[model samples]
Target: MAEKPTLRWGILATGMISSWFVADLSLDRQDAQANHVIQAIGSSSLEKGKAFVAEHLPGKSPTVYGSYEELYADPEVDIIYIGTPHSFHKQNCLDAIRHGKNVLCEKAFALTAPEACEVLDAAREKGVFIMEAMWTRFFPIVRALQQKLHEEKAIGAVHRAFCDFSFDMKIPSLGPASRLKNPALGAGTLLDIGIYSLTWTILGLEPPLGPAPARAAPEKTPKVVAAQSLDDGVDVATTIVLLYEDGRQGIATAHATVKSQRDFARIEGSEGTVIVEGDAAAVPSSFIVKKLDGEEKRYDFPRPGRGFYWEADAVALDIAAGRKENAIMPWAETLRVMEIMDETRRQGGARFPVDKD
Candidate 1:
């Protein structure tokens, strides 16, 4: 029998997302072949960390730490998963990388493009693996969509696309200011949900065209087209437009107050359209493809392990292979998404405390 690749994981934070991840990891363990294991959990308080472990992980006993620094220093831990809020991602990730530990950070990867770049640079210098935990990109449905777009050209020429995600958090009524509405925590609809809407755009559009034709004609460098943001101060809602060189346009919108039934996405082209129904952020259950020829195809994707094991599998495969990151959610792609979000915030006037002109 081949030896199982052992991946010792240390979790930072004990929030809702962290609980979900731990639950998924435990569920994966039922399969004897699973390679990942939780070794420790660190929270701001030792008692809280212990309670998290006791409540979430019943049988398996994992170490609990009062501070993240101790988790970073633990020799037994091979990788650390950061579940901290968006604003803390930069510092937490940097500290983990500096300690020579691989990291899997939850999205939005960081508060700003510059902060994300700093983490990328540190990962490169330290030779440590780091990845944004954009689990959707690792799912079977998303993979299938990518292949369909590239191989079948299901939506020929990719003329335009629209995606939306919204839910009513009822922030003002929820007293105590949940992180969802707290500006200090980098909370808003854009960074929280807009990132998912933007994923479709990124997947469809190729990189921007080189310098504009006119500027190059004079043998001078062209001015870079900076991204535009909504500038609302707090992004309760946001709309982003992405333009491609081939005349393709992508529209993504998100809101915290409204309830969008499908959390849908549609891609239109010269030949046909592809409609994905269900929360794109979650593992989608079904999709439909309609051709110009009046033919229709429907697809139903099976849910596996609460829709998180696929990402866990990707992490295990990459780590065991000694790879620095998953190609599916490459560091470059993550940086691009952050850049877009930063610009969106700037346009929306959604400024975090750390964002200085």
Candidate 2:
């Protein structure tokens, strides 16, 4: 039997995303290739940290630190999971890396591409693993789709791709200082939900060029011609056209304050179309291939743990193998996606304070 390993994770925030990530840790069958244990909770308030454990991480007594710095200093923590708001990602990641801890940061990797590049460089200098938690890319269903569309050529000669990720977030009534509405906190549909639509674009439309981390900066970045409608200094809805160097085009849409039920990401080519369907378009549970000859095939991948554990497990496995970055969603991929979104926001007049920096 292969030696099963366990990785200790320190959570940086007590937010909803943090809860989801830790909850999935339990769903993982412990026997295995890798396992995750909650080592610590680093929140602004120790009381809040303890409260989070009482609720989200019940029965698992993790060290509750009143500050993130304390959590970073923990000798037992193998990796840090940064679930702080989008605005704090760069700083959170850098802090964790400076402490020599590996990291899994929840996406939008950073408020800007430069920020992403800076943090990636820091992690590289520190020689620790770092990955943007584009959790969907780790899903078996998405992996199967990628293999079919790219390797098997299930969709031949792809020409166009379309994706939409939106929901009724009710941002208008929320406090201006709230993370969801505050530009200071990197709030916007583009940086938050729009990433999902753009991720599908990169995964489905871009040439299956195989994820090769540039180590330096990426050579080619996609061109984003886009527009958006902002509400109270934040993008509420946006539309984008991604033009790839190889002449592939993707049409994507994102909405933060609108109600959308029929959300899907699909790619079309000469051979057929691959359609991804789920309540949330980002982490889909199933996919289908529709051929022009009227042949339709469907695939279903049951997500026993709400689809978050795969990425966490992947992080543990990669670390065990001594890899610094994940091939599926490499640092270059995160940087490229950030650049596109940054430019898209610039075109749409939804610039944040971070943009001026």
Candidate 3:
């Protein structure tokens, strides 16, 4: 049997998302195709870094750094996982790329498409692998559903998709400087949660999805129209409609005032419709397909440790193969989605400090 590839990870933040990613990496899954080693941790201070290790990664002795610079300079680290807020993603990715380290940055990839372009350009110049950590796209259940819809044509000729990623965030109660309400932190329903709704829209509408057709970037960009309700300059609710070149349409809505139902997304086609169910859009676990003939089928996936390990494993495999980007979640795709958000925010009247000219 061939030996499994191992990727050494340098964690760049000591937050909840980072903890979940590291914990998933630490799980001993017999079916995992690659090995993920938490090589180091970089936090704002030594105390916080040490506390993160003790609590989330107990019994593992990864070198901890008090500063990001120290972590970036470490020679033993193979890749840096940027779990910081969206506002910091561009700089974090640039710093890691400057150090010639691979990166898996959390989404929304940046405050806008232009910012995402800079990061991707830097990685391309540096010849290091980098991918936006849209982990939900790598879920086994999502993959199976896509295969059924797009490959098998289970839902023949998709016409429209509706997706919602709403939850009661109680935005009014948060302080002005809170991450949920602060524009400086890239706070907005469109960027924070609406991106998932857009993801579902794209997944349901785009066909033959394997790195969109060559030189079709212009044709692939959807026509976007949107509206947003703001709370002290932060978007509290948003609705975006994407019109495709082929006449298909997708409706994506997000808000902070109500919890979304378990079946948060529906893709309707000529022959049938697919209903997606999950705790949230970010952790989709199952789907049901209902045909016009009254036949129905359901698919369920067992999620372990937030299901982040799938993307981590893909990163390891990509790096092992000397690739600078992933086919599943490539740079172009990241930019494509970021462009959708950019247009959505533009039409919706949501602007951040970084977006200022």
Candidate 4:
């Protein structure tokens, strides 16, 4: 057997998400498909970058930079991870792509579908690997359940699915400038948590694996109906209903004011139902398959580090294989989900700073 490929990562932000991702990469998982090395950390200030490295990585001695451009220009970096706010994703991705860098950008890929298109188009032109970091889709639990439901036809013909991601964010206590309350930063339940809910619904309804079926025309895409509750011009809660052409329905929801149940999602089929439960929709760990014939099966996954390594491992393998996009979370899927949120926000009246641009 040969050694796994190594991918040097340049982390572009020192936020909470970046810390979690780096921690996962630092773990010593024997089953990892590839080796991940933290080559550098980029921050607004040199001191901040150094602090992040010291705090999150401890003894690791990765290079720290005061600016993003330096990290992008570093030849040692095989890829750049963008953990910036939603509003900054488009520009951040474009800048990295311009530098000929592969990218793993966090979800809510952009503030709008067109912005997402611009970034993806740049990556395609650059001929580099680029994917939205919707890490949930890469989880072992999600993969197993998806295969069981779609590939094996475990639940028979699927008809409807519902998913929700909600938490008591204590929005009232947050200042106007806080990312959770500031419209300028793209603060909203839809983009933040609702995207996960929408992702689960899509997973339950669409078969991502197996041989490609005949491409459905644009008109075949589900019709989106949505509603939102606003607090001081920011959406605090949102609900979306996707009506498919064949009469199948997918319901997705998110909220900032209340917590959701452990069983946050369900996929109903002709013979059985799949009940998904997780600490959060974004970090699903287990699920149960209950059939009409009285057969029940359950599955759980080991989560050593918030489950970020699954996506990172997949990304490294893709880069090593010279693929320009991920098969599981492909650019088309990212754009489709972004468009769904775009329409959802449009109908929900949740406007961010990017709308004016």
Task: Name the runs in model 1 displaced over 4 angstroms.
Answer: 1-4, 29-34, 175-177, 206-232
For 1-357, candidate 4 gives per-residue lDDT tens digits of 977999999999999999999999999997999999999999999998999998999989999999999999999998999999898999999999999999999988998999999999999999999999999988988879888988899999999999999999888999987878898888999989999999899889877643224433323569999999999889999999999988889999999989999999999999999999999899887899999999998887767878899999999988898888887888888898999998998899999877852
**Which residue pairs overlap in candidate 2's backbone?**
none
Per-candidate Cα lDDT values, in order, are 0.78, 0.86, 0.90, 0.91
lDDT of 1: 0.78
- Per-residue CA lDDT of candidate 3, range 90-127, in tens? 99999999999999999899999999999999999999
TM-score of 1: 0.89
**Model 2 lDDT per residue over 1-357, tens place:** 667578999999999999988898867464335777999999999999999999998778999999999999999999999999888999999999999999999999899999999999999999999999999888888778878887788878888889999988889889888888998998888888889888888778654445445443443766789999988878889899988788888988998866545438889999999888887876697888999888999898876767788888788989998999998888878888888888898899887787773
RMSD values for the candidates in order, in angstroms, are 5.4, 2.1, 1.7, 1.9
Q: What TM-scores do the predictions have?
A: 0.89, 0.95, 0.97, 0.96
Give the distance in Å from residue 50's predicted Cα in candidate 2 to where it truly belongs.
Answer: 0.7
Say which prediction, candidate 1 or candidate 4, comes out ahead on TM-score: 4
Evaluate residue 243 in candidate 1 and report its C-alpha lDDT on the 0 to 100 scale: 70
User: Which residue runs does candidate 3 get wrong by more than 4 Å?
Assistant: 211-219
Q: Report the C-alpha lDDT of model 1 over 1-357, residue by residue, as the tens digit.
A: 766677899999999989988888777444434477899998999999999988999988999999999999999999999999998999999999999999999999999989999999999999999999988776677767766765678867668877887788676665445677677788888888888888865554432222222221211111112332332346778788877655677888887788766738888878898888775445566678889999999887876456666777778777787888777777767877887787777666788898987
Whole-model alpha-carbon lDDT for candidate 2 = 0.86
